[model samples]
Target: MQEPPLRELRCDVAVIGAGTAGMAAYRAAREAGARAVLIEAGPGGSTCARVGCMPSKLLITAAKAAHDARRAGEFGVATGPIRVDGVATLQRVRRERDRFVAGVLSEFEKFPNEDRVNGRARFVARDILVLEDRDTRIAFGAAVIAAGSSPAVPELLAGLGDRVLTTDTLFEIPDLPRSLAVIGGGPVGIEIAQAMARLGVAVTLLDGGHALAGLRDPDLVARANALFAAEMTLHFGTKVERAESAGDGIRLTWAGKDGAGGSGVFDRVLAAAGRPPSLRGLGLEEAGLSLDEKGGPCFDPRTLMGEGAPIFVAGDAAASRPVLHEAARQGRIAGRNAAALVRSGPTGIATPAPWVNLAMVFTDPGTAAVGETYDPERAAERVVGAVDFSRQGRARIMDRAAGALRIYADRAGCLTGAEMLCPEAEHLGHLLAMAIQDGQTAQDLRDRPFYHPTVEEGLVTALTRIIDGLDAR
Candidate 1:
């Protein structure tokens, strides 16, 4: 059976953006027996596969290899004069990044040609979208805006030409810069700054705020900040006031909050400030949908319905939770509810319980915050148990002993949240997330089997402290 031509067509649901959330919504809508069309603008690939997570991790892996080799002597293994070939290192990153993107493209191929449109979509009316590139108008019964985000380059760095880089442009560089100034204290900036520093680049990280990687606990933040400062120069509560062309490089002048200021010349300046939702020029107002302060759709987070209209928003466009898994969940919910609105009209749908909140930073001693993280307002009701991995048995065995873990519980010992700056914190974070979601107590987690002389033993030690704290109360 042949589908109708694109000159004039109506879809039960029209999904904008071909990234992670958009793709999921399109497939989900079809599975719900709705006629859906997936729209994209030119080049198609997820931010993670193309530039964000995959490529950054590749670079970090190479840096870790170099760092480990340099420290092998402490483990009684001699690795003499470890050298990193910057060109070869980045070439491999690009090579592997292409393969990951190819995998995402393969998923795109599964959708039929008639169901995919290649153009930027803008809403002309509540039920109508115009593809600006081809002048094609599509009428949709319901819609999902999963359009992702873009790097927010600071106004100060705009005129520096190619000397400036963002995560989107960082991987494409042919070689590592001799000196780098990373202008952000967020995850992307911290991860890339440390990676470049470890890979023999002189890195200076500048942030206007004092927080490091979103850790609320001052102790953990201090620990992580000290660990990162040991490798790269960090300036917090400071802003870059000026940038200009220098002889073969760029010069940046920065001012501290306390009236202190300095200047430096660097081969490149990375604008890791932030990634705002890519919502400009989408004509969202024309669709009768209001936007939030962040320029994202004002919608119900659970149903993803837009302000009582027949529209939905997911992924970065929602500007709520930008994580990939969260985006995929929102996309699924939006698609299903859109189909339901078309078929049965907005009733009898059971919204799932809220998801567990988890976040991780892939730095040397990884950092993670899971579930109900530390809050000063709730401090009186919470008991915190902490363990320093510096003394943990397995940490000493592996010579990777440099971080701490803290678990939080209420007076009754029910696990509430956990934060860590520890080696292999990713695994520990996941374990804690599951326990918190299941309403497990500190005593319950302590009873769980922990293999001897492993990083996980540190978790057991922390759980025991929580139980002890509970008993004391």
Candidate 2:
């Protein structure tokens, strides 16, 4: 039998991966008068909108609600034993996730300048791509590799059977296990362990390094540790040697902080050991593109163009540390630059603004920070401001007094970084990130009026402290 003919199509920009970044880039390209085509690996949506961020957050909220209900008596509310229907809660989360994904798909369908293709895409050349749908082949023009990363499952524990689950497959679990051993101390592992523990599952979180190492604030890390300690067992400085299936559970052999070998058995083993960018079989080498040491496509920082101007990379596939917000920002920039390249022919600079702000959202007491952490060696003088949540009226009222807001600036008052571990830390962190990215000083945040009695009001108070300390000096 003869092979099917390749379907040829032309567009000003071709965005591969329909995740947050791909969608943003597609829309931006269309707005810039470029006909865009969006290609996705799975379906039309992404794990972020479907199972990753949205569903996981919903499950976390449900878990938190169940936990609060059990403690209602302490808040002067008479309540019986807290009950949680894990299956029903999961169903609701999936439903909402589906709706959100469908809404995004609907928006893509409505765009006249954007074409959505469902298939696995590989490079035919630098600028050309061949998308495979079973036996059909479709080609495109300029390509954007937004192919995001997947849950990193270590090779040592790969042979473990059904008991082993990654973040992508955790939501599909038939029922909540009696005990869960979460391997990895990063955001995904911590969040999953905490969520499951709150849902009444006995959880043990093991991380090779200290937990929340990226937070860079000892006090914030301690606060998170204390909060997590109330529910789950956290084993820091623990390395997983291997995993084997036991009778009804899985046995994990690990090295403890003292370098002693220890064993743990759990009903299920969740591998939350971060992610590796999805770059396999994408023909990157055929297109003369190479990945960095961090497993992301190598690209010029100024242009974000890898190998050639016709091929661009963004999102998780391009970034060393792929955060959703950063991916979207890079995607928009890449899309605009790609369109500009196609329109104006050869250009030196693709986009003027590069991705600068990176934010991470943790459920409940989340955190956000931008720019570099204060380094004594790199600074002539450093100014640090901090205010405990216990002093914040809203935090006290909300009964969440574990976190704080801290800001770091230079002697000249340029915002270097800010960390908020409050109830609304995630949102408040964005404000700080914007300020720092915009080169705003502590006075800018101090002068901004926050809503009365809100968690964000703590920002103003924290900045006031920084200003006062400066004046006193």
Candidate 3:
């Protein structure tokens, strides 16, 4: 019997992936009067709602409540002993997670049915895509690649056969393990390790180097290490060479940079190494797009456009900024530019103004970095403003005094970047980002009102140090 012919469809723009960036790109293209079709493979909810941010935060919130209750004795307000129910805690996490995913699905419902394609897509030509499941061919004037990302497992941890988990699979477990070995020291690893540790799990965090959560300042890195070390086992400068299934647990053997080696066995192993762009089987090379060292599409960061093709890569697929807000911004930019490519043919459009850079790790005393974070290699070129939060009035009053803040300024006295490890650093990160975005000087921020008896007042102390440094120069 002869097979049926493939169905053919056409659109002004074809967006692959239905995550944050893909959704934003589709909306922008449609708003620009372009026919845009969104192609997604099975999973519909974005990574943030599904696994990355929301669920993790829900878990962390539960962990924080338990931690605070255990420490109620410091405030001399103790009702009774605190006990954590692991099963109940995770049940609530999954329950709240489903609610958040439902909201994202509602947004997916808003898109027109004709614009949605349910299948995996691969580029067969520069302007064409073939949906393998539907046996449909789509021709587009321009395309946006927003095909999200997945957790990557290192070769050393492969074939362990059981109990090896990544962020993608970690949250779905029925209950917390008695002990966990976190195999990466990046943001995800650090956050999960701390949260699990606080919830009565023995978490051991291992890293090949001393870097903690992308902190660039030596002082801050040391401070953060000291803080985290008090709670869990930290094995920096240690490289894991072997992992194997040992009865009901996994055995990990490692060698340290100091010529020391150690081995341990844990009930579970979490490979929080990193998340690479999920572009497998998309046939990027066939689309005439080049790959970088990390296997991401080679595209201009400013326009999100591939160097030699009429294709734009955004979100986690672009492998630029992996956060949700950055993904949304890239989606809008890529969508607008893709539509312009369709409407006005070839000559590029003006790029949107860049957004301020802000990132945070949701640890107890959170870590935040805004703009160009401090780098010791360029120490002489910038002035540093420092504050010890342990001495801040609000921190001492609240009995949560265990963090530091560092703000950076150029020689011209303009506020440039900041890195901090303090309670509510997320808010401080946003405030600093706005000042830097507005091109404000250290003196300008100093003139602004700083309310008394608040964590924000710590900013005044740091700014005064910057002014003093400027005067001395």
Best model per TM-score: 3
lDDT of 2 at 469: 68
Q: How well does model 3 score by local distance difference test?
A: 0.91
Candidate 1 lDDT over 326-365, as tens digits, reads 8888888888888878878778234777788999889989
> TM-score of each candidate?
0.97, 0.92, 0.98
lDDT scores in order? 0.89, 0.76, 0.91
Q: Positional deviation of 218 in candidate 3, in angstroms?
A: 0.7
* RMSD of each predicted structure: 2.7, 2.5, 1.2
Identify the runs in model 2 with alpha carbons over 4 angstroms from their true place. Answer: 111-114, 133-141, 374-380
Better of 2 and 3 by TM-score: 3
Clashing pairs in 2: none
Of candidate 3, the 10-residue stretch with the lowest lDDT total is: 345-354
Model 1 stretches with alpha carbons more than 4 Å out: 1-6, 348-350
For residues 208-291, write the lDDT of model 3, one tens digit per residue: 989888787788889899999999999999999899888899999999999998999999999998898999999888898888
Off by over 4 Å in 3: none
